[model samples]
Target: MFYPLKFDHKYIEKVWGGRKFENYREDMPEGKIGESWDISAHESEMSVAVNGKLAGKTLKELAEMYPQQILGKDIEIEEFPLLLKFIDAQAQLSIQVHPDDKYAEKYQGESGKNEAWYVIDADEDAYLIIGTEDCTESEFKKAVQNDQINQYVHKVKVEKGDVFFIKAGLLHAIGAGIMLAEVQQSSDTTYRVYDYGRDRGLQLSKALEVIDFQLQSGKRKGLKVCGEDYDYSYYCLNNKFALDIINIKTEYEASGEEDRFYILTAVEGQGKIIWDEQELELSETESVLIPAYCEEYKIKGNLKLMKSYVPDLEKSKSQILSVVE
Candidate 1:
């Protein structure tokens, strides 16, 4: 019998990282903590169960043991379908691009990356680079050679509660003084175009090969305010996954159908998730994995959460549209 399962954080340090992770966990190492992988099963890093009988087990092991229960009956995902992380960018990240699935499989033996970012907070002047202006291959190459890349790069100012959907092959970068939640395919194949004088070998050749020159610049619009009363919003709903933000007032009930499992992250406030005779005290920045086919559950309290899961696009689309209309 599966209940709500929480996972321990896997902290990673980086040159552009800051100390924002201290708000989520107290045992972080003394260094610039860049990201905390909240729920992951990627080969590079994995999360461990933090509660109940499955405590200490890696997410990979749990999925393998209870495939249909944890990942859904129809989810034939090779490993985990999604990777969730909290990123604290004290400084700018490298301007980079990720190949599509076909390109990645042929060259890197991995899946491609299509990610979404939900800005949790941002400094007064924080911004991001999404893509370049319309330019021919020769024009882009010349800009790179002349160290005038910024001239073609598209920059957009960001603020709290903003969201962006970064498709594969788009040249983009997360700017400094921003903290956000990232959801993406479980791949880490990055081809950097620029690193702002970091001296790290740039993947210029590979990045140029995969870059989508026609992709428009700027970030995606904010989450769609689908439902009335501002109780629900649809952040993203695509072939790979669906994400929704729920604003709980007094109590909210969530169903667990057999086709998909839900990963819920409490982004603000405090609450208790109760199901199957088990209850977990959910705090800010904590996450829980509710297995597929598990009993229905109730979230009680005033809080905000991001819910993600594999989705049947056709059926999910109609369902969402009806609610919004």
Candidate 2:
């Protein structure tokens, strides 16, 4: 079937992820809100354009309409496998963790959450809480009880165009005023640790039950920059199920092959992707999926893109040539 793309909106009741990212504006005259973003928004599950289009349609629509043009040759129809999102942190998000494949199999067999963050925009002092700093179970529990979590987790200053890979079971959160895009395994299971003394009627007992005690026993130093920092490239914090990032003024083209489907997400920029007969234009914080069976795909029009496909650089030359040709 042919490619179907649409723009869907996600309105979360949570106060942190508001609707600033969805309507972002630039400094130039026409640059006014060319890209989609959120200032205080949560649950970046919406804005899914390519695969599950038409604002909550059936899976059959995806299968019959955009089959060869959505997922790849190696994947199955039942395994959508990935969930893409755009998140804006107007305020600090909850310090939380997730369950990996093994843990999820044992505890939540149907749920596995592994996600990565691509920094779309950040303040001069925007910082991120990734993993733990140094806290034993007792100390962590006490900190949680007293609501003093700032001393427990590792924090790092961040900037636009930087990418951090967040694996399942990693304790992390986005600080205030940071906009990001996330790609993950299609599960939304999250365990919140602390929430800055806010009363949402949610208890922390559930989080304590799932928190990993082993990691807290060890110390984790945040990604450090001792001196001046410039536009640093993507440093994969973790690649649990996929690769994620934030790019700038660039383009990526994945020539169709027998391996995997090409997932293209635009964190920032104005660009067009050429896939088979489909010519898709992408703006900031938008995402699209290009199926593998499709013909030679080309990407033009300068933009920052984050791309993920199953890593198969080890394929034989004959097989590689057979597909791209």
Candidate 3:
């Protein structure tokens, strides 16, 4: 049966991780937990269902067995299109870049990554490394070799609710003291350019091939639309995916789209999703998959949710514009 599905958090430990997630969830394992793969179907890490009759099934299995029900009728892709996660950067990350679709398919046999970060919380001094200062390929190469790359990178101060779109080929790094939720195309291919002298290999050759020095990177001030009971913030809309922030004052009613499924993640506060006489609790840092076949649903609570899905560009644009008009 198609119902809202919740998954077990897959915590990944990293050298730069910390116990920051402990503030929001109690299931955090003891260690430097860097990331929680909340909703994913990638080969690197697939999310497992933890609620309803679908309990214990991996996302990949469901996608393969019930593609139409799980991914929607218009989503022709056999694989689940997006990967959602929470990142806690207690320490700085390496400077890196991901390949575009054409390059990735020909070379790495995978989809390109186009990701966006939604800051949930951050220290007063938290920041992020977006693109780099103006420089030629050779000059940027030299800086990396000489450990002078930091001098050429642009750092932006971040605060809660800040959003950044990291398109493929844009160089970036997550600075320390920040915790955020990330939504991206389902791919794990990354080329690290600089690792702060850590004992890790550098992918300079591949990084140079994919880095787009001219690409502009900065905060995304989403278009806001007010609703009777809530506020909607549309952050990104592209062929890859669409992202929106729904701020529920008391409750919100919605229905599944015919073309694609929706992944609703509660980034702040708590709520319950009701549909077909069934309901699921959604608390901070929790995600629920609302399958395309779901006819209707309602979210009730004082909360903020990050909604992501594969999009039909024209249809999505029209839906948002309709409200503005």
- Highest-scoring model, lDDT: 3
How far off is residue 317 in model 3, in Å?
Answer: 1.9
Cα lDDT tens digits, model 3, 1-325, are 7878999889999888999989888899988999999999987888999988889999999999889988999899989989999999999999999999998898889999999989999999999999989899999999999988988899999999898999999999999999999999999889999999888888999999999999977899899988789999999998998899999999999887666899999988999999888888889888999888766889999999999998889988899788779
**Candidate 1 ranges with C-alpha deviation above 4 Å:** 217-230
TM-score winner, 1 or 2: 1
Q: Which one is best on TM-score?
A: 3
TM-score per model over all chains: 0.94, 0.73, 0.97
Winner on lDDT between 1 and 3 is 3
* lDDT tens per residue, model 2, 1-325: 3342433434344567555654643321221122232211123433333333343453334535655555556555434566666666777888888877666667666456766677888889999987776677778879877878778888878888676767666778889878877767766667777888676544356556556655531122223212122121323333334453324334444465545564667777777766656676777766665556555666676666676554444343343355447
Q: Best to worst by lDDT, what's the order?
A: 3, 1, 2
Superior by lDDT: candidate 2 or candidate 3: 3
In order, what lDDT does every prediction score? 0.84, 0.58, 0.91
lDDT by residue (tens digit), candidate 1, 116-215: 8878889999999998887887898888878889988889899987778888988899999999888888888999888888978888999999999888
Task: Determine which window of 10 residues in candidate 3 has minimal summed lDDT.
Answer: 253-262
Candidate 3 stretches greater than 4 Å from native: none
Candidate 3: residue 85 lDDT (0-100)? 96
